[model samples]
Target chain A: MLKLDREIRDAIVAHAKRDHPDEACGIVAGPEGSDTAARLVEMVNAAGSPTFYEFDSTELLRLYREMDDNDEEPVVVYHSHTATEAYPSRTDTDLAQEPNAHYVLVSTREHGNSAGPVEFRSYRIVDGVVTEEDVTIQE
Target chain B: MAIEVRIPTILRTYTDGQKSVEASGSTLQQIVDDLEANHSGIKERLVEDSGELRRFVNVYVNDEDVRFTGGLETELSDGDQVVILPAVAGGC
Candidate 1:
C-alpha cells in the first residue's frame, strides 16, 4: 500500500487535467530511504503523445541531481493515462526502474480537461510485473 | 570506478542481491561492459545480440534516457548514476 498526501493527490489530478489528450508525467521526491513522498516535481512529457509518455531528458537529469543534493529519491513516479484505465501499461512497467518507488497512474479519460471522477491508482512494478496497491490519502 | 550503477530488483540477482554497484567507464557502453565483467548475465538482458538496447529495457544515464542522449555512446562523468529498467506499458 502507498500513502499520499491529499494535496499531492489533488496536484496530480490537476496536472492530468492540465495535459488532457497528451499524457503528463512527474515524480514526487522524498528523503532517501524514508518511503514518504513530500515534494512534487512536475515534468514535461517528451513524447507528448496521448499513447506514450517520456520524461524530458535534460529536465530529468536536473531533477535527479537536485534530489541527490537534497538527499532525496523519487518515491512516487506518476503519469496520466488520458484514455486508459488507471493501470500500468507495458511501456510504463518497462520503464519502472525504481523498485522502491510507488508507480501511480491517474486516468483522465473520464474528466479530460475538466474535473470529475478521476481514477488514481498506485502500483509496484518490479521486473516488468505490476502489482496494484491501495492508495491511502492523508489529510 | 566512481560511477554508481543502480541495479533494479530483477537484475539484482546478477549483482548478488546488491541494489547498487560502482564501476568505471567514459561511455555508457564501457560502463555496461564493466558491469558485465563484474555481474554476469546483466548485459544480455539489457542489450540485444544486435548490439542495441533491448526494446523492453530502458537505460538512463544520470536519470536521462541514454537513447535520447547518445544511446550506448552517452558520455559519463565520475559519480554519475546509471539506472537500468525494463520498459512496460503505463496504462491499461
Candidate 2:
C-alpha cells in the first residue's frame, strides 16, 4: 500500500485541477531507502498536451542531481489524466522506469476544474506489468 | 580518455549494480561501444537498430544533452561526466 499525507494528496489534486486541459506531472522525493513521500517537486509538462506529459530534459537532470546530493529518491511519481480514469495507460506502463516508485494517477475527468472528488489511485508498474495498489491517506 | 558514466537505477543490472563506471572514448558513440564491451548487452538498450539513441533514454555529457550536442557523435574529453536517465514520459 502507498501511504500519503492528506495535505500532499490534496496538493496533487489541486495541481491536477489547475492543469485541467494539460497533463500535470511531478514526483515526491524522500531520503534514499525511505518509502515516505516527503518532498513534492512539481515538474513542468514539456509536452503540454492533455493526453501526454513529459518532464523537461534539462529540469529532469537538475532534479536528479539535487536528489542525489540530498540522498533522496523519488518515492512517488504522479501524473494526471484529464479525461480518463485514474489508471495506467499503455504508454504509462511502457515508459515507467522507476520500478521502486509508486505511480500515482489522478483523474480529473469527473469534475474537471470544479470542486468535487477526483479519482486518486496508485499502482506499481514494473517490467511492463502494472499492479494497482491500495492508497492510505494519513492525516 | 577516462569518462565517468553515471548509470541510472534501471540500468544497474548491466553495471553489476555499480552506480558509476569508467569508460574511455573521444565521442559518445565510442563510449557506448566501450560500455557494451565491458557490460555486454547494454548497448542494445541505449542504441536502436538504426544506430540512434533510444527515444526514451536521455544521455548527457557534462550537463548538455547529447541530442543537442551532436547525438552519439558528441565530443567527450577526459574527466567529463556522463549521466544516463530514462525520460519521465507518458501519453494517454
Candidate 3:
C-alpha cells in the first residue's frame, strides 16, 4: 500500500484539474531508499498534448540535481489521465524505471470534484509488469 | 570514457540484469553504439531501421530528454548519466 497524505493527495488532484485537457506530471521526493514521499515537485508537460505528456528536460535535470544534492530520490512518480481510468497503460508499464517508486495515476475524465470523486490509483511497475496497489490517504 | 548509463528493468536483459553500465562517446549515438558493442541487440530496441529513435523509446542525458537536445545526436561527456525509458501513454 502507498501511504499518501490527504493534503498531498488533494494537491495532486488540484494539479490534475488544473491541466484537465493536458496531462499533469510530477514527482514526490523522499530520502533515498526510504520510500517516503514527502516533497512534491510539479513539472511542466513539454508535450502539452491532451493525449501525451513529457517532462521538460531542463527542469527534469534541475530536479534530479536538486534531489541528489539533498540526498533524496523520487518516491512517487505521478501523472494524470485526462480521459482514461486510473491504470497504467502498456507504455507506462514499459516506461517505469524506478522499481522502488510508487507510480500514481489520477484520472480527470469526470473533470469535476463536485460531480463525483476522481479515480486515484497507485501501482508498482517492475520489469514490464504492472500491479495495482492500494493507496491510503492519511488525514 | 566511462559514463554511467542507467538501464530500465525491461532492458536489463541486455546488460546482464545490471541496472547501470558504462559507455563512452562524445555524442549519444556513439554511446549507444558503444553499448551495443558490449550488450548486443540493444541498438535495435532503441533505434529503428530508419535511423530514427523507435517511437516509444525515450533517452535522456543527465535527466534531459534527448528529443529536445538533438535525438541520437545529443552530445555526452565523462560522468554524464544517461537514462532510457519507454514513452508512456494514458487516455481512454
Better of 1 and 3 by lDDT: 1
Q: Write the per-residue lDDT of candidate 2 for residues A1-139, one digit (tens) a residue.
A: 9999999999999999999989999999999998999999999999999999999999999999999999999999999999999999999999999989999999999999899999999999999999999999999
* Error at B27, model 3, angstroms: 4.3
Per-candidate Cα lDDT values, in order, are: 0.83, 0.96, 0.82
- iRMSD, per candidate, in listed order: 4.5, 0.5, 4.1
At residue A97, candidate 3 shows an lDDT of: 64
Chain A TM per prediction? 0.98, 0.99, 0.95
In order of appearance, the predictions have TM-scores of: 0.79, 0.99, 0.76
Off by over 4 Å in 2: none
- Give the C-alpha lDDT of model 2: 0.96
Clashes of 1: 14
Q: Candidate 1 on A1-139: residue-level lDDT in tens?
A: 9899999999999999999999988989999889999999998888778988777555655776688689898899999998889888776776677788899999999979986989999999877888999999999
- Model 2 per-residue lDDT at A59: 98
Best by DockQ: 2
Q: Evaluate model 3: give its TM-score.
A: 0.76
Of all native A–B interface contacts, model 1 reproduces a fraction of 0.33
For candidate 3, list the clashing residue pairs, or say none. Answer: none
Give the candidates in order of lDDT, highest first: 2, 1, 3
